[model samples]
Target: MKKTYDVIIIGSGGAGMIAAITARKQGKKVLLLEKLPTLGAKLKATGGGKCNLTNTLSSEDFMKSFGKNGRFMSTAINMLNKDDLREFFLSIGVQTDTKDGFRIFPVTHNSSTIIKALEAELNRLEVEILCDTKVERLLFDGESITGVQTQNEKFNSSNVIVATGGLGFPMLGANGDGYEFAKELGHKVTDLYPAMLPIYVKETWVANCTADTIAKAIIRVDLKKAKKLKAVGDLIFTSKGLRGPVILDFSREITPLLEQYEQVPLLINMVKGKNEDEVLQHIKKQTALNPDANVVEIVSTLLPTSVSKELCLIVGAILDKKFKDQSGQVRNDLVKIIVNTPFTVTESIGFKKAMITRGGVTLKEIDPNTMQSKLIKGLYFCGEVMDLDGPCGGYNLQWSFSSGNLAGHLL
Candidate 1:
């Protein structure tokens, strides 16, 4: 005889675990399936293993961060905002702290702490968890979910939540299984793109600046159509190109453009938003104070020695000469480079290095209020498997927990 559950959740990532816990808390016979032998493999890698659980932003501001489709997260966030999530963690004997005063993480600063606590709570709640179980397909009876078929057996459930996350970290068991299931059920899966990853640029000079991390750098797309796309954070030059907080956030916009254009030009303000005039004035002040200072030393006041030298080379300024001794055109060009260093991005590192997947099942077929599928009764969706994605800083994880909570309610 096939065992039955009131609610069956596929995948045991954050969303799947949370959904199982929520359903079991309601006294429903809940079962969680995971293809991986261990649960929360990707969650363990979140925030580079610190596990940023959520943030302190208000629901309105939080929704705005996800952009236009962010409105779809209103009900979910309203039900399980940051405060609620913290309280829930506290209930399970896990402490959290926000040292940065915005991003939240377990006090231990280890993702294993959060995962272990959740696993303990799930065990305490008597939720059935089957690791190493691969779900082949959702059993849909045309208009409703009947159950799910695994490689070895069939589990019967009227309500099933497909919390299988998107393909981001393939090494961590991400395979786009949720998107496949959604497509099989007649849901529209949006074009998937690898996001939150480092990009390789056409300029090899960036290799020279790889040792220094520019703080508060501003990066913006140079294209007229994408003039509004910009991000501000710490920027790191890499052997291949650029990475760090700013590039990871802005990569979401660039990857989609990469699908259309051969190369994407970027204007990076490495001098912390200083304009040409401001940089020139700073150089002038430095030169007046130290007349012997060469172009490298003068520019090094605003940038690292390596970066300063690289910029001087780009503008063809003599390194050993005083800033005033440089040709007028060279001086102007140097200031422009100081304000906006140009890089032509040729390629992204792709899914292997991406932190998240940009597109998944379209939101049009899913109810944001309950996370239930509008096309099929008793079918629900949650987590990164959905079309919506947000920038770093706990937005994606918060969305997973909130949507899972809403989906588990079976409302």
Candidate 2:
């Protein structure tokens, strides 16, 4: 006799766990599989282990964050939104709160709190969890999903939800296995690209600014035949390259251009909301008021010492020369360096460092309302497995939980 479950969920990430819990709540037998030794391995590492669960953004603004692909998630999010997610977690005994009005976190501020709460709920509901169980492929009849094939055994289920994450943090078991399964079932898997990842640049000065942050830098990506893309937020300089909210948010657009071109140029406005004329005029006034101050000193008044010095080098301005002694051309050049700084992109640190992938199972094949595959009956996809990636600050997890919740309920 073969062991059969009412629902078989592949991968024990956020989406899979939620699906299992939901199905179990519906009085359906549920089996959750994880390739890694521990469940939610990658999820535990999110938000530096604080586990940013969801955002407080309005439904419309929240959906826009995922780009055009976000519209595909309308049904799922409408069914289980941020408010509903908060209520659900509270019901499971995980208290929640918010910082900065948008990012919501566990009241305990520890990711383990979330994992433990989910595990406890699954236990209470009698959901079966199989950690260290690698699901290699799906077992299906020609008409629908019949079960899943693991290394040791085949468990039967007409309802199978692939919540296996995309090819990010592979060491934590996010290996794009779900894409293969989708393709085998005749669903189109879109070209995958890394999003929310740092980019290696040709600017060597970025190393000197390592661990330093430009509080309000604006990043603009200029791609061939494509309109320039821009994002504004705090940007941190890393030893290897650039990393931070602004860069990560723009990474999805950068990845494809970097692949096609030898090097894509990234324009950075170090000072937000300041035009070239305004910045240059301000520098002139500052130089006149403090004639004895060196050019570097004058720049340091407006920018960090490290960044000011680097900008001086880029503009070929004399570091020790008094600001009053500098030519007007030098002042204009210095202002341009700060207002229109550019970095030549080499490549994005691939899937290993990516927070999420930009592409996966094409959205058209999955019903937005149910997260069920239109082609393969009873086969569903949710979370990063589908072609949806949102910006930083907890948008991605919202999609995972919402889509998983919708799928589970529909099943």
Candidate 3:
């Protein structure tokens, strides 16, 4: 006799767990498989151990934050919604609150608390959890997915949910196993690229200041044949280049150009106070304030010291003489320096360093409403496996939970 379930969910990340629990709540037998020794490895790493669970804003506000695929996700989000998620979390005993940006966090501010609450619920419901088990392939009969085959065993089921995450944080068991499973069912997958990844700037001083003092800097970018994009937030200084809240928030568009051009120029808008003309005026004032103040000192006033000195070197040729003796034209040129600081891009980090992959199972094959496959029966796809990706600040988790809830509760 073969063991069968009403639903078989692959992967034990946030989406997988949520799906399994939802199915169990619906009075369906559920089985969840995890490749790692324990569940929620990726969840544990989220929010730097705080677990930025969900946003409190309207579903429209939340959905729009997901980048291009935002509209496609609106369906699932509308069904499950953030308010429902909050209620679900509170019922499970993971009380929550939010910071200034309305980014929700576990009230306890500990990720493990949310994990434990979830684990307890799954325990009470008796959802079977298999750990240290790698699902190697998807098993199907004709066009319908029937079960899954592991390295040492197999499980059959009428319904199977592919919740395996994309190629981010592989050490936490986020390998692209779901992609292979989806392909086995004859679903075409889009080319996968890393989103919410860090950028590698050519200049060292920019990298350092981006890491330390001026960790948060707004960026204005002009890409090839694309509209100008601006990002305002904190960016970090990485050993390779830059990584932080802000840079990672908008990294998806950048890394690709870096690959194609090998030197994608970026404009960093450092001085926040004034427009370009006004900036030049400020520079003039700084020059007259102290003819003795070197270019370095004047720049350090407007920008962080480390980054200011670095920019001085890039435009050093313009003001060859001492600041005290420099001409008015040089002062104007100095003002131009703050308005535009361009750096060539080298290469974006690889998948192992990505926060979430940009592409996965193409959205067209699946009904975004039910999260069910239009090509095949008894097969469903959700989570980062879809061709959808979101920026940081709890958007990815929101997508994961909404999709999981819809897939689990749907007929």
Instruction: For each candidate in the order shown, give its overall lDDT on alpha carbons.
Output: 0.93, 0.88, 0.80
Summarize candidate 3's per-residue lDDT along 285-332 as a digit string, tens digits: 887886777777777778877776677666653334555455666555
State candidate 1's TM-score: 0.98
**TM-score for each candidate, following the candidate numbering:** 0.98, 0.97, 0.92
lDDT leaderboard ranking: 1, 2, 3
Write the number of the candidate with greater lDDT, choosing between 1 and 3. 1
2 versus 3: better TM-score goes to: 2
Compose the digit string of candidate 1's lDDT tens values, residues 69-102: 9999989999999999999999999999999999
Q: After TM-score superposition, what is the CA distance of residue 346 in candidate 2 from its true location, in Å? A: 1.0
Give the Cα error of residue 125 in candidate 2, in Å: 0.4
Steric clash pairs (candidate 2):
none
Residue 3, model 1: Cα distance from true site in angstroms: 1.4
